[model samples]
Target: MTASLEAKAGIRRHAPAASRHAYVTLVTNDDYARGATALTHSLRHSGTQADIIVLHTPALGEASREALAALGCRLVEADLLPLSDAFNARHARRALHGAAPFTKGRKPDFHTPLDNFVKLRLWQLVEYESCIFVDADAIVLKNIDRLFAYPEFSAAPNVYESLRDFQRLNSGVFVARPALATFAAMQERLDVADAFWPRTDQTFLQTFFPQWHGLPVTFNMLQYVWFTMPDLWDWKSIQVLHFQYEKPWETNHPKSEVLMPLIALWQAFHDGGPIPDIAALPGPSGPAAALSPSAGA
Candidate 1:
């Protein structure tokens, strides 16, 4: 931030988008928009100098878009599903999200689940040398600039003990090079894959990069431990706290006691001050809450 436009223009020439590094995420609907905003706010609060990028579908409302823009994030909107016969049947509506072995409320069943795959579009950020993707439903407790030093392809293990597990390489937080060639490769692979196993972008990525480096658990310490075994919770060392279905916005749920404290941190970033009591999100309001288009497109 300098006063001289000529100096700034010179700087921009040196720091073209090709040399940029960023943190990326996505929001296909209003439900996750709030979380994405919090994520951006937290990154800025952590003093990151690199770009904070978000890939969203056109369905996102102006409020959510403005919220992200307010954090100095670069929001790139794109049409995720292209009109082509090359599409994979695995991504078809019925096969989307794969087998729902989890409880009813654990995952989305509608077209909402389909847009989750759009995260793969991250590779299209060809201008970036490398980018770290963090799921919107997460909290960045501290600066994680260290991730930028790791390999172009790296991620923390999922909430599991064995790396061999399908979900062990969590897609929630990862570092990767962004290139058009790689993006095309991913698109081609998706077109040919029988199905996105376990039904998500993580599975597709696991298939593509078998030798990806594994980052330490501190980078993506999940909150699952707190919910399953409250006594064993270790709050001090966490770099990121990921909340899935029952995110911070859903405040009226029965887990208010467990959620409020965690939600407080996100509120602190969102409000730009002391964290207030978290509350349930009201029904979608005004044009910002327009009915989202089907992802089948």
Candidate 2:
């Protein structure tokens, strides 16, 4: 067997053997509060035994902070200082801009998954032995305890392999070890100077850990295909469902109806009277309406 084969086997062997604590981190910016809120409730409802936290930029005002605080999670400010250490001020600012892509426009600012990738490193710094980073747009359908069965590099592959322009991995969900050195080494490869610089975080990661394979597709089901895979609907097969395109609150989402469970959970817990009307969602071409009433108004 080749060295890569030996290493893969070794990593797999260590995956189930390591006993560790698991926590979930949802990284967001101001605009994605609804998705973040829904995710918190979904994870809590599933009785995830791990600590849950939100990582948002410092610009979030007191009212928003207090609101997220009410969810009973430890709110962490993904501030400037640490990022300054990893990247220069200009790059840090660019990274900050990337993290909150929901702001400014319906589309994300950067072409790469840098936001999620950076948050993954940020979560590692916070001291969780093993951490699961879920996008704010995702909801947990079942206890994903077995995800901990894998080691530092685990994720789901993109449905279209040809889309791997630079071999970018999927950013929706992943699990990793807290070993900073391993990640730092990965960052070195992401050296802001690479000629074939990754357009997204996953691409950089794909290059960093060439040996990383993805988890079974069932774990990170893409919402776009609920109709395509209805026959494969073992709800238990899905641990975290990614709301990739049209979020539950977005207008004209062909599949927002599919997120009824999440919408119901949001209504039951949030003091906000009722979820927005599905009819109010933009009809596919228009921009997504904001979750906050002011934005909607």
Which candidate's TM-score is highest?
1
lDDT of 1 by residue, 1-297 (tens): 232642322211112352378888888777688888788877876788888887787788888878777767787775655524424454555555444443422443313655767787787667777788998888687789878778867987775323354346888899988776887787777655344455467777878898889877668866544444344345555677776555666645434444455666667776667533223322123232223332011
For model 1, give the 10-residue run with minimal summed lDDT: 6-15
Off by over 4 Å in 2: 1-20, 80-114, 160-168, 194-199, 227-233, 252-297
Cα-lDDT of candidate 2: 0.53
Residues 143-195 of candidate 2: C-alpha lDDT, one tens digit per residue: 78667667767877754223342234566777777675775665556555422
Q: After superposition, how far is residue 3 of candidate 2 from its true place, in Å?
A: 43
Clashes of 2: 7
- For each of the candidates, the C-alpha root-mean-square deviation to the true structure, in angstroms, is 10.0, 10.8
What candidate 1 gets wrong by more than 4 Å, as runs, is: 1-19, 83-98, 108-111, 160-167, 229-232, 251-254, 275-297
